[model samples]
Target: MLSDRRLFLLTLGSASLASLAACASGPQRVERPMNGDFPGIPFADWTDQEPEYLLYPGDEIEVATPTASELTRTVRIGPDGRIALPLIGSVMAADRTLPQLQQVVSAAYAPQLVRPTVEVTLRQAGPIRVWVDGEVRTPGVFEMIGDLDAYQAVIQAGGFAPTSRQDSVALIRRGPGGSRMMRVVDLRPRRGEVVPLRRGDIIFVPRSTLGELAAFFTQVRAALPIGFSYSINGSNGSGFAQF
Candidate 1:
């Protein structure tokens, strides 16, 4: 039978070996909505699956018909979210997918022709509008062209100011339930650290807490006393008579 001390040493050695094996396996990648610290906040990845691209105002689309070339044309969604195609006249295009709009256009032209085939392709995406506020060189609403990350978005907004915090950034997103949630992004610029920005997303860069503490300490140091001196005066006896 094994003694108690021997059993204890054996267990400790096994634990150490397991820990070393875990380290050799390399660090695990962190997925968003991180554990205890960042609860309820979800960070979106740059290579996430393509979301349902809804048609919005100012979006340009190309419509084509295999059977009828005359019916094909490129059109833009108006401010009222409607597009004027060749034969379909004015059709609602907002809040619709490309496939959905193609079906609508095909059905509209079906009455006028023996056979109508329609295809809709998004030629140009609408302004991917996002707001960059707090600690940036230029803080305002910006219309980004292509895929943008928080770091790239801040650069587009004129980069970070001197006081801007580069450690972490805040991203505000409106959830499907209409409630707003904020995620904290690490701005170390490591591989796989680029977080994709969505339309209506808000990026806020704050001042560093360590910077504030340093400033406070500087002020305190300036106000502190450099040096001090003290002197005591004593008089003996009376004038000079008693000793």
Candidate 2:
């Protein structure tokens, strides 16, 4: 007995409800090749080529001058990535290997003392930290007690949220020459792949599969909670962004 227009409206409402129900049940898994031009390496193909020990801001080191014992002192690398010495003043210390720093210090003090030999030893290393964000129950920075992979770090952040796209998580890291490097990692169960995390690595779990790396950065900046700052520059064509 219903009118034709009323019948059509009823059918449309029923279809919308059905669609919502399907979405509530679970996400449909789609298997597709990642974008070839995406500016990130595949997690499976990534290799860790970091130096043995790169100095950080909080690292404490012993600068010993055997030739001039009085000049020997222990100092911590300041937040500005420099250490203040007796005669040479502030010298850049962070990112330099022990031997490289030793040579720099020796050269700096060459004019002040004869045979200005300097031995730099790491007295204490700084805390290792990583940032885990997006679609995780608890998103924040965490200290790495030991070796942890991308998956394990997410677990520490209270695991992935229900809407997380576990099949395609983004891992951003600092590459050579301070450039940004990103990798797509699969954290689905039984995948049996391990993407080892390095200090300052960022594990971002997208709510859905990302089509473009540049777009992903914009989404990250928006989703990040207060007290966190992230920015991207898409205009310059450099594709470099700060996180």
Candidate 3:
């Protein structure tokens, strides 16, 4: 009998092969109408304000206390998204902006010190990485360099496999408040469109066109290996789902 892991892999492989075989029957089609515009993100949501940099694990940050020089120290954020300090102990630091973290550390040390002034500075940033899987020649986590879009990241993973459903690719990103947001992007050639990707983003190329965004999420979660957890919270009218 195949081990559980082996059995799961075999099942996933069969599903992928079936999807590819379906694609071979005809040209891939977009199941949902795009209405001549990209779905998910809205134009009004675009803003000129630059997004604040959030701290991540493996990032080295210098926490300075001018009043209490002895308590000042530089520490790298741990995998648990925390940093240990003299008086405050372990403080959650990941996913917080520099100013936000400074406030948090200062508040934690307030009772111990007369007037606590904490300054958090990014000494070194952690490696920016993204996950590319499904129908890609090489599917794995890759360190991102400079600006990259979903299509560019796929190219970094040795482009799409022959059986990849190029017209429908899934981009999963971390949404506000730790929610997972998924968007289906069209990566066909000459589309003159790009879906910008951020650190820790997941780019999944499916073997067949994704019909309904909700159902596709379910299929993807099951088809992927263990550890890829997904839950659909709800969907926006424009093919976006929060998981």
Candidate 4:
């Protein structure tokens, strides 16, 4: 983490008046309401499966030979909703249907691998990384995978108490021109009534604007001291650990 004072200094140095105004005025793009009480997207039109047309990066997945019980499984998926297979490398797997991906994988491995058995499954689907960055009991990043709506996303971020303003949660997405804002979700517990998450989605549960200021101060109080650290990579087979 960058030091708070340094971060603030950097922000001040880099940002122009117009940029600050833009960031302060509001996030770009439209704002939709989270609750379905307003009534939209007539259930009939909503499909149970994601679109097989496009795949973005950051798709967490697991592939293995189910034919044998000795699970020879391997996995790979970045935070952007993509899958990496043996010969095919990384293919957009977020939106593609299973059958469609299966065919693609089979064809890719046909020449080099003999009877190359492969299966593509989304261990965690969706590219929406819900960043709970403000006042909450527990705050961090939650990978918005399959069936993870606002409520579930918040729960994974460790839920909220009475202090939480359910209606204040906002979803941030990057668009063609700039960062777009989509619907402020009112965190509520509901089973299977959430929208299907797409790749590159960023849901931020911000408190009220003043609440935002308080959050900033809270962060300031925590960073009285500064520090840094690093770790070495690479495991040499047998018992990879430091004593």
Cand. 3 Cα-lDDT: 0.66
Report residue 175 deviation for candidate 3 (angstroms).
5.3
Give the C-alpha lDDT of model 2.
Answer: 0.66
Q: Candidate 3's residue-wise lDDT over 178-226, tens digit each?
A: 4444445688877825877787777777765434334444655664454
Mind giving the per-residue lDDT tens digits that candidate 2 earns over 38-64? Answer: 323221223356635677767899999
Local accuracy by lDDT, each model? 0.60, 0.66, 0.66, 0.45
**Winner on lDDT (3 vs 4):** 3
Which residue runs of candidate 3 sit more than 4 Å off their true CA positions?
Answer: 1-50, 174-181, 190-192, 209-243
Of models 1 and 3, which has the larger lDDT?
3
Residue 16 C-alpha lDDT in model 4: 23
Per-prediction TM-score to the true structure, in the order listed: 0.48, 0.64, 0.64, 0.37
Query: What lDDT is reached at residue 208 by model 3?
Result: 53
Candidate 4 per-residue C-alpha lDDT over 153-236 given as tens digits, one digit per residue, 9 for 90 to 100: 667767765555455454543333222323444565552236444544444544433445444555445543643211011154
TM-score of candidate 1 to 2 decimals = 0.48
Better of 1 and 4 by TM-score: 1
